[model samples]
Target: MPLPHRVSDLSAFDLLLSVAELGSIGAAARAHAITQPTASARLSGLERGLGIALLDRTARGSRLTRDGALVADWARTAVGAAAALDVGITSLRRTRESRVPVAASLTVAEYLLPHWLAALRPSAEGASVALTTGNSDDVAAAVLAGEARLGFVEGPDVPAGLTAATVGRDTLTVIVRPGHRWARRRSGITADELAATALVSRERGSGTRRALERALRRGTDRPLEEPLLELSSTTAIKAAVAEGVGPAVLSSLAVAAELAAGTLIRVPVVALDLTRELRVVHPAGQALTGTPRTLAAIARRSASLDDPAG
Candidate 1:
């Protein structure tokens, strides 16, 4: 509904109340940090809108007339209520800015997010982060469904309803137990050879699995063989590979420790690009703001340090 003209300018009403309380136009103007003439003009406009003589101007100063006093009393309620409303809105905004909900694929959650969040703490003030870990597909779904305000994904493709920015890069590694025959090869295997072999692999929706499949599809026309075994977590895949279950494709970030410890061997794949982008995603039409935006910036900076080339 349209506001009535008489009460439309709340600032004018506030000035009127101030004038009534202070008993002079100059004092009211000083209290509101406005010049006397400006305050007088605003009150004049308000009186005209309300169709009432609101002030009695004299040589010494200005004072509220009988009608003006009645209006001032009524205006006080509105002005006080508006003040209360402003406080409430500010509180709500602060609460929203201090809480951030994020979804991330397993690899990023396990390896990257802890550091990123740690860096976020200083700038975030008292803001708290609620993290959800899942496969890339699940992260995308959470963002689309409004279950998470921001999402990090390791897969190559962004979901249709989300906007994404590449925050970093990760390379998939072909790892095997030291006793496996592929571990002994001084030279890497071809894409066709890798695709034909059944290896312990992540579940279908995992970003690591998706990245490997995307790379192989580009390099080979041969139908990709099924995994010898499907495991859900990178830790499980690493454990299986360590026990000589078979070779598995994993993110280099995931197998760094085992490789350093000589428990796992990295087998290079020839002419196949195993690198995939790490991305931060949000709903397509909405702009990221508050804590989410700050966290994304932190994530990008931190990830860049992880890959100096990014």
Candidate 2:
């Protein structure tokens, strides 16, 4: 069977996947190390060649239209295959041993994995690693799909179909600009108060956002209030909160530096247990071995070192 001419260029399919992931052509372009105009042109060309509109552009950002969503889903398979090929080719070209590929949540990838990797390297005689970053849900999916040998996630609940063990714990800290009213309050804000406010938030499906919503919805059936701004990146959220756009809940690991520098102040939430487990997960019923087992041991050791009880 002849393949569609529109997808003959794998890079164009990659850009569409990036657009779906990043929620904007500009952001996707930046991620791909291309100009916005280039990304726009590629997307336009893809749509024209496919004879279907794939994206709906708005002032806020671009989103997949109905047909676009289906295309993006199909594109994901192609991109995944390409990624596997890239990894394989790189491994073949390398003289040294192949690196273990791990998928991790943004919080873990940004703040924790580097330290763990460093700790693992010397002990494993200079082991190498390839890390992929995504939301917890995405990370879980990667592990389950065999795209990664291991995965780390920070959500309140473990994703189904993956076997998981709690490797560590982290708390969600509510942060606001120094000048925000919450920073000056003597009392911590209540769950009810938090639910009533429209604040900066991670995008839906993010573990950080899910943990926050779970805390807010406890003891009541009320729905969460819409966010003042929904950003896919934690860096964006921090920048928005630092500018006093609104209060936001983020991983304490993510905000420690900002808190110490006084650029962002922590606002305690009364009656909220925002603590969540950091988990290491792999495919269900699969026994850990090789690099995956080694990495997991290092992670657990690091977790123990951070905890006084260990």
The estimated TM-scores of all candidates read 0.90, 0.66
Q: Kindly report which residue stretches of model 1 are placed more than 4 angstroms away from their true locations once superposed.
A: 1-5, 35-37, 304-310
lDDT of 1 by residue, 15-126 (tens): 9888878888999999999999999999989888889999999988888899999998998998999999999999998887787889999989998999999888888898
Error of 1 at 189 (Å): 1.2
Q: Where does candidate 2 stray beyond 4 Å?
A: 1-97, 219-221, 304-310
Q: How far is candidate 2 from the true structure (C-alpha RMSD, Å)?
A: 23.0
lDDT of 2 by residue, 67-157 (tens): 9999888888988999999999877745233467799999888988888888777666645778889888889889988888899998877
* Candidate 1 C-alpha error for residue 148, in Å: 2.3
- Highest-lDDT candidate: 1
Could you tell me which residue pairs clash in candidate 1? none
